[model samples]
Target: MAFFAALHARMTGRKVGQDRFGNTYYESRKMMPVYNRYRRFVVTANGQDPTKVPAEWHCWLHHLTDAPLPEDKRLPWQKEHVPNLTGTRYAYRPKGHLAMGGQRQASGSDYEAWTP
Candidate 1:
């Protein structure tokens, strides 16, 4: 993968600007051969979930950043990237989750519909 990346970059004469969360970005004074051609590919442990990537990486991927984020300059408002794993076991378990206990608390009252 790295070899192909290097080849493409070299052939295109793109300058590698930054890398974060295993993704790399490149730019060239010349336009890319393909439209919407992103210079970076995010590498993930399990793959999928763009959310798994950090905020900095997301910015680069979306062309929001002209330059990569610096380690010391991360903004206070930026939250750490967390993947949404809904329906999966790794998803966050709330205190009152049904999986933890067989108990089902009453919301107000159980209503039964009447039919003719």
Candidate 2:
């Protein structure tokens, strides 16, 4: 319930900035008091992938922008940040695959024949 209340506040907050992945950031001159201790006017996102953050909002979050988002800071060679992949299947697999190349022995049942 508290989380939902805080989310409501964030949705109605003074729209500060939005990220590339539709994540939005909000700020208040005076922190809006919350009934729940964990809920407050704090920065948050759906998840932590830096790439999810829009360029402008990311800049602001990282102290690069003073007025929401700046255009001059955009530059080439800036690799987009990707989320940490630790346990996902898409994660890197060294050299050994599940099917390592050990041939299975034929079943004894294969030699059995039907007598006409």
Candidate 3:
């Protein structure tokens, strides 16, 4: 958090809750005239990586719900949140991708070009 942002959060923002990603959420101590509600914000733990926010926290961040959906009451079928991995070493690369050694095992169904 920037010096001014940290000061602002401390001066007027009331701490709400924190999500699993270590991001902390807050609302203004008083209602704002524009929205007729207290302002809300989040201090992300991973710098500017918004993808680190889970679905439930995303809801609260966007004012989609009065509060974040319960974390423990998750349905059995629900999967845990995973941040976007694009541009990182953990990102998916096809078997033949140049970064993956540019080699892929040839199968019987593989396409072949004409020799002509």
Candidate 4:
């Protein structure tokens, strides 16, 4: 299924730019009938995770910005983007999380319980 999607995107879309992560961004060569506008999309270099897209590229992909990151002027204080790590080994696990393999730390007196 991904193969077909890639093929269709390649045939119908024009190359925009690639991010440091290797994800390639594309836009429809012609306006799409359904949306009545040109469609924009990205092909992830690693997996099917949408969060893999960086902030700059994401803006272009969602039509939030008219110019790609390369043409846009970035602020000096801007930092590089990072993808979510929910399912990976680097995913965050609180002290109480089951995967952490330890008993949950007690909630102090300030903790309040919610009632229906």
Which candidate wins on TM-score?
4
- The TM-score, computed over Cα atoms with residue i paired to residue i, of candidate 2 is 0.44
TM-score per prediction, in order, is 0.52, 0.44, 0.73, 0.73
lDDT of 2 by residue, 1-116 (tens): 54674577566566565555455566544543662212113234554344455555555655555556653476798766465566677776554545445455577776777799
How are the candidates ranked when ordered by TM-score, highest leading?
Answer: 4, 3, 1, 2
lDDT against the true structure, each candidate:
0.61, 0.53, 0.85, 0.82
Better of 3 and 4 by TM-score: 4
Q: Where does model 4 exceed 4 Å of error?
A: 71-79, 108-116
TM-score of decoy 3: 0.73
Candidate 2: C-alpha lDDT: 0.53
Candidate 3 residue pairs in clash (backbone atoms < 3 Å): none
CA RMSD, predictions in order: 4.6, 11.7, 4.1, 4.4
Error of 4 at 44 (Å): 1.6
Clashing residue pairs found in predicted model 2: 19-54, 20-54
| Candidate topping lDDT | 3
Per-residue alpha-carbon lDDT of model 1 for 1-116, expressed as tens digits? 65665667556655554444554445644655686454544444344456676666667667787665664576789775667878889987766688877566667677879999
Better of 1 and 4 by TM-score: 4
